[model samples]
Target: MVIPDLGRSPRPAPPHVGPRPEPGSFRDPANRVFHAGDDVLRALDRTAAADWRALAASSFFPPLLTAGKVCGTEELPAGSPLRELPTAPASSGWATVLRHERVPFVSHPYEWSFAMLRDAALLHLEILRAALPAGFTTKDGSAYNLQWRGTEPVFIDIGSFTPLRDGEPWAGYRQFCQTLLYPLMLGAHLGLAFQPWLRAQVDGIEPEQMGPLFRGTRRLLPGVLTHVHLHGSVQRRSAATSTADVRAQLRDAGYTRELAVATVRGLEKLVRRLDHQPAATHWVDYQHTCGYSGDDRASKERFVLAALSAAGRRRLVLDLGANDGRYARLAARHADYVVAVEQDPAVVDRLYRSLRGEGERHVLPLVMDLADPSPGGGWRGIERASFAARADADTVLALALVHHLAIGRNVPLPEVVACLAGLTAPGGRLVVEFVHPDDPMAARLLANKPDGIFPDYRRDAFETLLAEHGTVEDRLELPSGTRTLYRVALP
Candidate 1:
């Protein structure tokens, strides 16, 4: 495989078995992403090929990619596999195809903490500001166009860029307002958490929806007054307005080139000042109560490091139930990137903020429930990916997490092992903690349940299930005697 500017990534690209259309790339008719072997190729439509030419000549792409502001992209070779697809258009019509460097892991906006969302909002505006001088603008401002690279947010969708035109209201103005600004305002000013709302609606809070949430005096805030309340009022009253008429009005309403810059600057200022003090949650300080003595913690850390080393030190690591990211940080020391996912948003928000404040570019904190994980359900039933489908980590860590799923959640032992196995890539390592039923934590979890539910809950039985998929590389019994760590190698 060819290495690129992003440095070495432990997660290998998918093998180019043949040209397969990417499910989520269908909405943008201007371009479609295809997977040929391990490479992600974006085939431009006849209309978009010319747009690509314009973007390439803008002098904006090179610096952005070099500085890691945008996703790294390369022009596809003349004989690239785009021609192999049965639906390939006439080769003479289109002139370019773009290949994007695949992100190690794709976490959705719903999974991001407040800080992560805030950073994405700022980055979106940054791109808008930078591209203005180049005479280009993003046609769509969906949060999905941005992805996490370490702790920094980077724009990924090149197809979203389009040439700016005079006297036209920004096509994506409403989109930026709804997807980025509104959510931050809701969380920062209204003190409402964004996770639940963002989780339920991937498109983010709308002006009509968020505007109504602001009560009396809060609605008077400058940002809320203009972007939310006024915009929503206008949107509601435009039901009977003809699309052409509305366009005509916007065209004549002095939406000059400078107006676009002014709009972006206003949004940037508003987003930059947004803030909220996350309230403390039960799991926020749970890591401190861990009775894992110095020896236990030290032993656990050693075991995890060894497991990563065994796996060729994979760049991507997924930690399920990463409360405060204790093991997540340890994993990050050896891996290129570690995704610390916890069900509690408050804890995740704090951990995310900490990582950002320290400029640690190796960990991404996200919210995810082990019991009811995210599913794939969007446009054409594939715009969003299920957690299991996208979690292709080279090594999966589940320290102090299995008991929550097995006893607390009442999930079967074999099912739990299978789920963990599915999360790890084939031949990848699985580092997990097995809490015996006799342990205080496990006993408390099963206190309300009947004993007959978990017949194979013992460590011996757990190892048996793990053996079905991978060999046990190493297993350690902590000094506390309540927990055991296993580094299993999947076949």
Candidate 2:
């Protein structure tokens, strides 16, 4: 189960290497990552060799590891970060160990909301604050490096740390501006979603582009004028020159550590000052307005709680199409962590807002279209992970979700059941809803499609599909109508 975590490089490895370790570990020389069963094996190369040893010895990494914010560094064979790491003869060099976590889940900046992006920004700044005292600085400041462990943002790329050079400008300052600063400011001031802009500008928002985007808001804030407005104008004027003496001008204009820190603090304050007004959209309004009697809602909650009780609360839960996180919060009450997946952009944004409050550390909201989810893209299209690859949950909830896929999207019943089953971790529970064709919601979905594409869209057929994957531990029909809840689990 070895997996390569390269961001977006398309180059194939040449066969000039000594003994190939694992396929996943061969992506970079800086850190040769392997797996010895469930443990992560890191082979430090020249870039990470010295720092790896020193960082491991330091007190900083340990607290983060204990907090589940970063992976723990274990004692491998006494070796230099410059040397090649050992691997089993059967290893393939990229990833060759039978580890529990094959790779990190793919999270794009465009999918994140303002609060999520802000938290990631703060996490990176905190990392900078922590690592700076340890004589290291981050070489990269992309939002992609931040991942959510529940509601908390964690920095996973330890290899991004490099030896700090004094008297030089912050290497990642420009990246910080593009990745975090501009996006936050745009969302706060212009009420932009930031995802579309972020997706189009994968590297980061170019200063030239920022000029036009913020054309209407030139007088909003002093910091925006200093950083984005004026900076963008200067970049536009200097477009033809490659060897422009911009750094000296910036230095003369007082871009010192104190100024940089103050500017960042201002950005932080601005991110917090954002008032995320819930934009009006179909799913955002419809999820609350449509289809469910008071009794039905209560019955669904009872069914979910019962399932959660039977499943145990020590593990993680994945709620597919978790619109606005109504049920996800319920799952969060019982489980250690809950990942709420919703395709509707508006609903996900709203849910992200609810999960951002302080002390809420059990929910993670993701934007994904279940029918055509995010595919592995980037150089050679091998850097990112697909939806199915990231579905490892202790339990899965598919409440009111199947009908949309089964009839609206025309997915087969067996495939729908199998997809829900795929999200379950070992000994995990699957709580799903099966709405008969006669059900109001199911009828509405059927109306969208041609006559009789889903002939097997019956409750019995759904149960049969469940039987093939796991035993149906419990079943209940809501007092409202033909909608039913089933608790299925692998034996």
Winning model by lDDT: 1
- The weakest ten consecutive residues by lDDT in model 2 span 94-103
- How do the residues 1-491 of candidate 2 rate in per-residue lDDT, one tens digit apiece? 11323121222323443433433234445555554433345555444667765665676666665665554344444343423446434544322111212223346666666677877888788767666656666777778667775567777666677765443345676777788878887777777767666665556787777777656546465357767877777657867754335556566676555555555566566656654554667788766666888898898899899899875553567888888788888887787677788876668767776677645666788877788766654444444445676577778999888988888887887888888888786678889998888988787777877887778888888888999999889999999768999998875
Cα lDDT tens digits, model 1, 1-491, are: 12245544644555655778888877776677877766677878677878877787788767777778887787767786554453445444445677788775788888887888888988888888888878888888888889986788989888998887655566677777767777788788878877677667767777768856886898777598888888888888987997667767877886667777888898888888998767887688887765567888888888877887775667678998889887888888778788888998789889888888888778888888988898886775577888888888888999998888988888888889999999998878899999988888788778888867887889889888888989988899988888899988887
In candidate 2, how many clashes are counted?
14
Residue 304, model 1, lDDT? 79
Against the true structure, what is every candidate's RMSD? 2.8, 7.1
| Segments in model 1 whose C-alpha atoms lie over 4 Å from true places | 1-4, 9-17, 77-93, 239-244, 447-456
Off by over 4 Å in 2: 1-29, 52-108, 129-136, 196-205, 208-211, 216-256, 280-288, 311-314, 356-358, 412-414, 425-427, 447-456
